[model samples]
Every structure is written in structure tokens, then in C-alpha cells.
Target: MRSTFDFQPLFRSTIGFDRMLDTLESASRVTSIDTWPPYDIVRTSEDDYRISMAVAGLTEADLTITQEQNMLLVAGQKSEQDEASGQYLHRGIAARAFRRRFELADHVKVVSANLVNGLLTIDLKRELPEEMKPRRIAIAAGEALPKAMTKQIEAEKQAA
Candidate 1:
């Protein structure tokens, strides 16, 4: 007797995203074991996205944001003086070293980033080509036909 696993389908079905499967697979491997510096991802528009990280103790000079290949990297490291003088009875804020990466889609570009009230906001916008934009086409009637066809049409019009 054959095992139950033998009845499984040979090939799985994909909706339409064959290329995105690799991205999805890679994303699944990212285990959420580190939650020191929390972040949020928000979709502002159809092609606009924003990433906000709660970096209260991190200054602009301490943070670095860059795009390498297709990944957006955000890292930070506090100054040595700040680490030495800052004394806390119960320290909960993250001020050591950290790096976070986000995968970007094709043609998606980072517009800008700003730090306000201890929150860092990174904006991204996708720029599509002009040929990819939607267009409309108008159909024209055969109103301005040649005289030969016009004569045949007149003869048929007369016959009718």
C-alpha cells in the first residue's frame, strides 16, 4: 500500500507571482527574534511607502540609511561619550548597534528621511515608466471613404 504523501499534487499552483516567490521565500526566513528597536511600515499611497523606526536615543549623526542592490539598510550606533556619560537605573532604550534591512521592489526609490520626536520616517516612491501608464484609444468610423467605394455606396444607396 502507498503512503498518503504519495497522493499529494506534483506541482503547486501560483496565482501570478512567479518572480515574487523568491522574495517571499527569503522573507519567510527572517525570524522575528530581535525586537529591540521596533518599527512600522505604512503604505501612504498606491505607490508610496513609509518606514518608521522608534529610535529615541539615536541622533541623525548616529544613524545611517542606504540602499545597496535591492535592500534598504538602516543602522545606528551611539557615540562613545554618550555611552559613557549616560547613567540609567533601568535602561530600556536601545543605544548599542543595530541594523535593519527592507527589500525594495523594482524601480522603487527612496525619496527622503526625517527624524522628528524620536521617530525616524523613511519615504519611498515607485516610479513607473511612461509606457506603463494606462492609455485610451478612440475608434474612427469610415465616413471619409474613397470615391470608388463612395460610388458603389451611392449605387447601393440608390438601390436601397
Candidate 2:
């Protein structure tokens, strides 16, 4: 089942949240579109993450991972398939091309990707920029306000 949410009413009550709303709406639309080659997104630590994909019968040469802006994409193409000239009673395993996209938050980046034992393990870490990271905003103790600024403050106080 697909979820359809109307965000127009929410927009009227909020500001500076257009990006977030758009991201959520887009995510809801994309989730219902595809479900091939199962994958899992796990948060390992406070700022670390890992995406493990079950890609059995796949190799390193067939997988591609890329990060564009705040988006992470994982695509795989089966380069080697069973080209045998025999008839099989039951064909079950799927070795097909797939493309998976993830909407990553700011500061998150792909640290490394390793394919071990048919599992594509992608590691990610959030390294916030110095300016974006929160720090102490120290207030100067006993510092007097400038004459003009103090005059404006006094005027506002008297009016109030």
C-alpha cells in the first residue's frame, strides 16, 4: 500500500521547512516504487551509519556507489550470469540490475564500501563542518554596551 499525504495544509502553518516537507513527500513516493535486492540502513554510532545490502552472487566489479550532494546512490549490474545451455526445473535466485537511492542528511558522507561474502557493506560517517558544529557562544562578562545601542535599549524600556 502507498501512503499519500497532503502537505499543503501543513505548509500554511510553517516556515523554512519546504525542503524537509519535499524530502518526506518524495521519500513516501519512492518507497512504494521498488523493492528489489533487499537492503538495510543501520545507525552504528552517534554519527556513524552502515547500509548492508544482500547481494548474493555479485562481485565488486558489478557494484557502483556514489554520493551526489546530500544523496547516496547504490547501483549494481550483473556482469556474469549463468549462460549454461541446460534446462533447470526451478530457477529461483535473482541476478538482475538494481539501483537504490538514499536521501542523506547534511554532513553525512560515504566512508568506505566493502563487499565481503556477498554482502555489500557501506559505511558512512557524519563529519560536520567547523562552522556548522555547535560551540559555546561566550558572552563577555561585565562588558558595557555601546552608547548608541544602550540608548536604543533604554528608549525601548521606557516605552514599555
Candidate 3:
């Protein structure tokens, strides 16, 4: 059974969250999603992550990984002739075309990808800009003086 949710009231006052809300709504209706090529998302550090997908029969040539804005897309397709030439009694391996999209947070970017022992490991890193990072504000000696003290000093200077 699918449950319907009303997000109108919840998102009425939100800004810059349209895509995020849409993604959440779409994810709730998960009946249409394909479960092939199981994957794992691991956090290596505070800012680094890795996505490992099991793609036993696929090569780097057969897979395509694309990053558009905050969307990470991974897709795979096998040739029809390859399937026609071989017939298996019990085909356990899946070479079917599949597309998977991951919604990345802001500043997240793909670092590297490699196929090792049938595992497609994709490394990702979240790089925060300098302006967004925490910075220390150096206190100026004169700036720290109270306004009343500075006014008194100015008055004293004028009298002198």
C-alpha cells in the first residue's frame, strides 16, 4: 500500500528547498525503483565518502558516471549482440541497463572512480569554500576600546 503525503503546508514557508522537498516526495514512492547492482555508501571521514556498487560483469567502458550540479548519475548498458551470443541455463548475473541517481549536498564533488575486483568504487569529497569555512576574526587593539573611552581620549586630546 502506498501512502500519500501532503507537503503543501510543510513547505509553504521554506525557500531554496524546492528540489530537496521534491526529491523527498519522489523517494517516498519507491515502487518504481530498480534494486539491481547493490551499492554501499561509506563515510571515510568528515568530508570524504565512498560509493561502492557491485558490478560484476561490467567494465569501465560499459559504465557511465555523470555529475550534473547536485545530482550524481550512474548508468550501465550492455550490448544486445552480447546477450544474443550467450545463453545461460541459470543467469544469476544482471547485465541489464540501469540508471541510479544520488542527490548530493552542496559542495559535494566526485573525487575519483575505479573498478577493483568487480567493485565500482566512487570516491566523493565535500569541499567547502573558503568563504563558508569558519574563520577567526583578529581583534584590533584600538577597535576593542570602548566608545566612551575613545570619546574621553578625543576630548582630552582637544583640551591638550
Ranking by lDDT: 3, 2, 1
Alpha carbon lDDT of each predicted model: 0.81, 0.86, 0.88
- Which lDDT value does model 3 have at 68? 98
**Deviating ranges (above 4 Å) for candidate 3:** 143-160
Candidate with the greatest TM-score versus the true structure: 3
**TM per model?**
0.70, 0.73, 0.79
User: What are the runs in model 1 whose C-alpha is more than 4 Å off?
Assistant: 1-19, 30-32, 86-88, 143-160
Candidate achieving higher TM-score, 1 or 3: 3
Q: What is the C-alpha lDDT profile of model 3 across 1-160, one tens digit per residue?
A: 5486767776888988888788788777747757888999999999999999998888888899999999999999876667888668998788889899999999999999999888999999999999999999996665554556344344444554
Candidate 2, superposed: residue stretches over 4 Å from native = 1-3, 9-15, 28-33, 80-89, 139-160
2 against 3, candidate with superior TM-score: 3
lDDT of 2 by residue, 72-104 (tens): 999988774553646778868787799998889
